[model samples]
Target: MDGTVVTDRTAETVGADGTAGRDALNAAAAASAAEGSRSEALRTLSRVFGYDTFRGEQQAVIDHVVDGGDAVVLMPTGGGKSLCYQIPALVRPGTGVVVSPLIALMQDQVDALRALGVRAGFINSTQDFEERRLVEAEFVAGELDILYLAPERLRMQGTLDLLSRGTVSVFAIDEAHCVAQWGHDFRPDYLALAVLGERWPDVPRIALTATATPATHREITERLGLPEARHFEASFDRPNIQYRIVGKDDPKKQLLRFLREEHEGDAGIVYCLSRNSVEKTAEFLERNGVPAVPYHAGLDGGTRARHQSRFLREEGLVVVATIAFGMGIDKPDVRFVAHLDLPKSVEGYYQETGRAGRDGLPSTAWMAYGLQDVVQQRKLIQSGEGDEAFRRRAASHLDAMLALCETVQCRRAQLLAYFGQEASGQKCGNCDTCLTAPETWDGTVAAQKVLSTVVRLQRERGQKFGTGQIVDILLGRKTAKVIQFDHDQLSVFGIGDDLSEAEWRGVVRQLLAQGLASVEGEYGTLVLTDASATVLGREREVLMRKEPKRPAGRPKSERTAKGERKQAVDLPEEALPVFEALRAWRADQSREQGVPAYVIFHDATLREIALSLPADLTQLAQLPGLGEKKLANYGEAVLKVLADHGRLEAGTALEDDSSSSGAESPSGD
Candidate 1:
């Protein structure tokens, strides 16, 4: 027998109208049955979620778990990872227990599930004793289809005992990368989750994460004690997100310009390295007419929560934050994610940037990188709290990120390659390098000059200097520091005057990236590496990317122009007004319900509805995402909006009301 079985008892509950109540359906689907069948799963999916079919590996994953098999799934963000466990939980008997790291988002998660008419409940620190007791009662009685618990809750004997009392259908560990002890988002509590298998040997477990490299994938399997589980790794490519990195030149100004020219009035995120930077960036954006808020660990928990809530519930609000923000964000319409500072690793960068365009709309992942970013990151790793092996691992991660930044090939290809996936083509035509290729020049002499300077300073003067002093000496600026250090007297000094200061910095940056030099100590002073000898001996040639010149009043790159146009082109001109009207309606509903707008209906769904111009509830039900509950709840309202628009198009004047769809467009497009 399969793990899940829908019994004839459930079918007997159907009324003469051929419709079962929400409770009856949820109970029949979530509780014990005679067998688990794919046909039943499809029926439940269409009836509850309104999707005709599963996407990618969703069907295979669901089948394996429904048949009492464990799984470790690595699907990209926006890749329908939730449905992998969600469908099986509903198909199988008893409540599906989800161990999630996102305690802050449990309410919203449960709310979304409930909106689908699935009986979902949660137990977390946020709930009062009475509220938790009620949920516990629901679970014990098998009245809940799904039960969400934070990973930390599992460590409690009470939580374990409560689970033993209930008939658990399956166990899902979300954000499973948290078990990777060395991962960017490691949660120490996740190490305790392996006990789930020990406690409930028969219950199938599924571990899911949005981002994980091969090593992290193995680590999650080992840590979760799912070594024999079926592993499903989906392509990590988020093709909707266009990746672009620019050489940092007055990065704040560059960011402001990017926002103004391309993504004005759009919701996005700006990441900085420090809390102070986060605050200042948010303030700067606000002052410059961009509605922005700061979020970081420095802020109180309430402030952080409030800002996060605002970012979610309100449209076109940018959240400036440190790395603390964006792990498990479910907002689907973020237009961009800008990094003012370099991220630490390809994995971290990929995960952070993946937050954008979760709705599968055209979005951007932009970053401003420079020589200082490389230096600062190296210095942090050197002085960071870790042993030698940890520092080496950190350095390896940084090296991969730097390589992505310095690559002349397609950015998307390099990113995919880092995760052990191959791109379909050499050029994705969506990234900066593919759209506007940068020029590569031989910088062998430049590399030699920089290395020689380091050698002269260390050997002759027994001293070292940071990148600035080195550039000053190379350009022969003869600044006060140069005069004080008597650096101008060295033979290697002034030899690099042929290149501009910016160009020399590029050389130094590339040299460090190429392992020709290293940053040492607190001052970030440059020192020659073993590879420097090969370059100095003329045995190796250095190929460096020339920084593209951006003069004043320059035109925006074709990539940015195309991204802007792509968003506009998604909706036909005739259907745009209808889409806007539907969006306005959605915003009002979300505000009333205290949930994010997408939780009601995604912009994609609205766009389809507008294009199709569904005339009635029957027609609306034919559209994707209009699940049974959503159709019943909002179908009449949607049809009414279409009817009003139709009348308005025919020039039939209607009475204006406060809830009129004539209000300004809520999406800010």
Candidate 2:
């Protein structure tokens, strides 16, 4: 949700908030009934879906859709959004048509749904015409409860004709934010789905998006022809995902160090901006003792799918990929996500980082960014074909992302603030900035000089020029660009010599971020927006964080003394004693099984079995980390230890029943 829509589009608020309006009265009545109906719904939800309780606005949104109404749902990444619509589709009378963006996701989702005994099917580009016909027949006869289609297919003539004959219950658009061009992923095909109302007016519609800014929410409702949709906004807080952004310098080394120190044998993904980078990084990591695989658009479909399957099924394997990967992937145990390069916008940044900690365990979001990333992003946007209006909005978004990179404030606070949410924390103490304090300097005069230079340039040149050019003019360096442009004669010239070029760049980046300046893609110019004039007119104060010197060694621990992010062996302290005893017994059992010590019992399941201290096999399966295979194989031995010891606590020990003399094993065992 760390995104916004700052475009020329008009946003309309549909229903009145007062007491007596028809829409409001209807919405209130629906809300009242939802509280009472949850119990009945729960019986059906559990019997059909195997889920007991709703997660984060799921029930409210589902109720809104179920009772013949329109709604726009904004939920976080792992907030169980699919269930909000899926449950209602199951309860509805006719087939529910879901418009999604990805074909692979549709297949996986439908497979999972069918596994639950729901009548689900999908039509996408991957299917042949005959295959498509079979699916269409099933959908037309109401044999399929939920039908998934891409936005493009939803608008196709053949598909529309088929839908016209079938009894459509509701229309749900997944990833609804793609309807707006201002959003990160703007698909032209998505804009065509707005005519669903014109095609079928009576069907209740639901627009679902994982991350939407205020503007995006407005755009989605307006474009999708849902002017009177009820709104359900889930909180954007993901407390489990620890966020950290490091300044660019030896990024590869920092990544290696972080991986070695924290994620020695955990599953994770390292994202890069290019295919070559992905392959190179993956190979380097493998050489350094971590088993890793590279995935990108450059690989053939078969190879890519095979590698992805391996990564998902195996533990402790890292996948280095480009933006092409990790979309809608349901692998929940990804321990960390590392970005080798900075993203173009905060929305893109948030979406990428949100992939970590999906299982609600402790995880890290690490990024390495620099000024070069800013320049490249500006060049890309400038080169894109669009009106000046589009360029300005894109530039503003990029500046906001850059500001996030350079801020001394809490990283989480700045991130949440961009999406118009107030993060109630003075210090997150998880990010690099929060872990180590930065040097702050009063750059009021320097800020004024930079603004004055922009004004002297008549605000014509775009904001893409580096602070070096402006600082040169201010310090009277007489650089060629400044001399040719006659910027050296300005009164602001020679006023910023107290600041170095790197320091000045930081200020310019912050100014752009605060909306004081705008970056122009054409002619690679930098201009000031209306926000900049206010700063120059003394209405806003300018504060900047000086770039901290790269620490000679590792910075002090960002976590607290208790190891806030310390990756322990996933064992409870109360059962550690039993774990030690089992590990020793397993070490001796390895000789009998003719296998390695870990082959007999992994540290992960041993920890779980020990924590449960299961006196019987039935109770052992209920423990946190034990699986069917583990429970079947190690059930008896693990239960024997707990029964013999009768739940030994962390520091206590039990007599060695396996040893004839009943002696305790040494600490190493």
- Clashing residue pairs, backbone N/CA/C < 3 A, model 1: 5-33, 5-35
The TM-score between candidate 1 and the true structure equals 0.91
Instruction: Candidate 1: count the clashes.
Output: 2
What TM-scores do the predictions have?
0.91, 0.72
lDDT of 1 at 618: 82
- Once all C-alphas are superposed, what RMSD does model 1 give against the true structure? 8.5
Candidate 1 local lDDT, 170-250, one digit each (tens): 999999999998899999999999999988989999999988989999999999999789999889999999898988898
The predictions' CA RMSDs to the true structure, in order, are 8.5, 10.9
Model 2, which residues run further than 4 Å from truth? 1-37, 425-437, 444-542, 551-555, 558-655, 658-669
Strongest candidate by lDDT: 1
Residue 271, model 1: lDDT of: 94
CA lDDT of every candidate: 0.88, 0.73
Per-residue accuracy of model 2 over 1-669 as CA lDDT, tens digit each: 111221111122233553344554455555556654565566557655544577768888877788778889887777777777777777777899999887766766675565456789999988898988999999989899999998898667988999998988889888888888898878889888877888888887888877778888889888888888899988777777777777666777878888876777778889998898899999999999989999999999888877776665555789999978876666566788998887878888887788776666677888877655665677777788799999889887887888788777888888888778887788876666666766677766677778888777664443245556776876679878888877677677788787777667767766666656656654445677787766778877777777655522225553323332223455555566677787677757755643434344445556666766666777765664343444565668777777666644322433444452435555536
TM-score winner = 1
